[model samples]
Target: MNQLDIDKMVLRLNVGYNGFKFKESDLKDGELKDWAKKNNLLKSDDKQKD
Candidate 1:
């Protein structure tokens, strides 16, 4: 999947499980990427290419 798709899934998980209130716009930055990395949802070298 792409970055946006990954972010959406992560957002849903967070909102559903952690009671977060983030919107789709919030995922435009690297917040979900960092969270996913910290939670091992992403690999250390999973940086996306432009």
Candidate 2:
């Protein structure tokens, strides 16, 4: 997906789980990427054995 799609998806999913009160300043691009990795929503490092 493009950046816009990713942004929308992140915002919707974040707020849905968090609540409308989550300050946008609390997010970073890396956090989104991290979430995708940790939960397997995207992918994890191939060399990661943890």
Which stretches in model 2 have alpha-carbon errors above 4 Å? 21-50
Task: For candidate 1, write residues 1-50 as lDDT tens digits.
Answer: 89777766866686568866543233444766566545544323334431
Candidate lDDT values, in order:
0.54, 0.52
- Please list the residue runs of candidate 1 whose C-alpha ends up more than 4 Å from where it truly belongs after superposition: 23-50
Q: Pick the candidate with the highest TM-score.
A: 1
lDDT at 20, model 2: 46
List, residue by residue over 1-50, the lDDT tens digit for candidate 2.
88856865776675567544333234455766555445444322344443
TM-score of each: 0.42, 0.38
Error of 1 at 23 (Å): 6.1
